[model samples]
Target: MTQWVFDLGNSRMKCAPLQEDGRLGDVRALGYGDDVAGALDGAIPAAVTGEAASAVLASVASPARTAAAVDWLTRRFGCISIVRTQPTLAGVRIAYADPARLGVDRFLALLAAHARGTRAWLVVGVGTAVTIDLLDAQGRHHGGRIAPSPRLMREALQQAAAQLPAHGGDYLEFAADTRDALASGCEGAALGLIERSLAQAEQRLGERPALLLHGGGAGELASHLDHAMLAPSLVLEGVALWARLGADG
Candidate 1:
């Protein structure tokens, strides 16, 4: 049977084929719109829609959206596994006092990073929210922080002050116009948080951790970060590992 993994984030859903070697194949992302069911039906290949396939899901979306996805997948795949945040999984140990409170997406990202190697890592996810997580060399999570992403920040500003446009402009030290200022402020805030987190992680680990960037907004911040590696499918990669380990055990 073909195995698939789905990661449902706040804004979109990412799905990929899980190879026999426990790696991810081509990933497909579909944004959540008015007709999520229709979008899923159209995006998923017909061959993979039958009971012959299996699926694993890691979701950080609303319960309603998750339910909608689950309802659809139930009719398509034979078996489905929904991932939850565990205190410890594989070799990674989560730091959350209440593991269930931690977002599954962040937890999965940690899993993928630790599986890669025994190096301290700073995983930054730039999507609906900018999430920064630190993983030690021994696969121990050092907590994390979440803040409004640049896009969200802009939107919030626009909502609060109708004069501000929710999009456009460039990042500058000192923006000449309102559009540029909004972009600069929002991007600068996220950048500052990332930099601060990196410094704190370095101090706590006694060594600089490798920066791993992911999510839709990562591209905007990647150029500013030195030695940052982009791992767009980190969450899906973790889902594959989770499924593989589950099958093995």
Candidate 2:
């Protein structure tokens, strides 16, 4: 059976099928276009499916849009998708007091970490916002925090002050000049927030979690994070892990 998993982010929906070796088959990014379902349309992308796999999983960045995307995939792919929830999949047990409040992206990132590494893992997703979630040594979900990202800071400055150039999340080098200052201002804000959050969390938790970074801006964050592994297909990774385990039951 073909194993397929999809991750729908704000700007694009990404899919990764399972190869014979069990790694992600091929990575396909479908940008949001006319049809909300267009996020899944492409050259069969992987082995085209008449029916979705025995199981399917999805991680939607925006909670409000999750239902529509979930329905769209189930209709198009002919599979019932497991939306990350309080209990989540049968694989990882979430101990977060308020599991519903957990971001599906962060939750999935934690699962991805569990699949590949030891416990006491930290998953960082860098996008419109930055999320840092901790999975204890026993794989229990310890919850995490979210803060403004570089783009968020830039947008705030653009709104509050005039004459500041609006820059989206771009990997660019700025010399120590006015342009750099603005860039620094935006990135600095995000940096400061993450640094303090990580430091404090480590102190309180008493064990530093392995840092796993993912998202559109994951590359940009690797250089800044002391210990980070760039996980481009994290959402997909989580989806794949859940679906595989679900099919067993």
- lDDT score, candidate 2: 0.69
Candidate 2 local lDDT, residue 53: 55
TM-scores across all candidates?
0.97, 0.82
lDDT of 2 by residue, 1-249 (tens): 676777777766777778765568788876764455555555344346657453365655555566666666566565666656545553466767777767677777778888886567777788778887777666777667788777677777888886776674343455456556766767766666667766766786796667788888777668876877788988788777666556442
Which residue pairs collide in model 1, if any?
A: none
> Ten residues in a row with the worst lDDT in model 2?
38-47
lDDT of 2 at 223: 88
What TM-score would you give candidate 2 relative to the actual structure? 0.82
lDDT of each: 0.90, 0.69
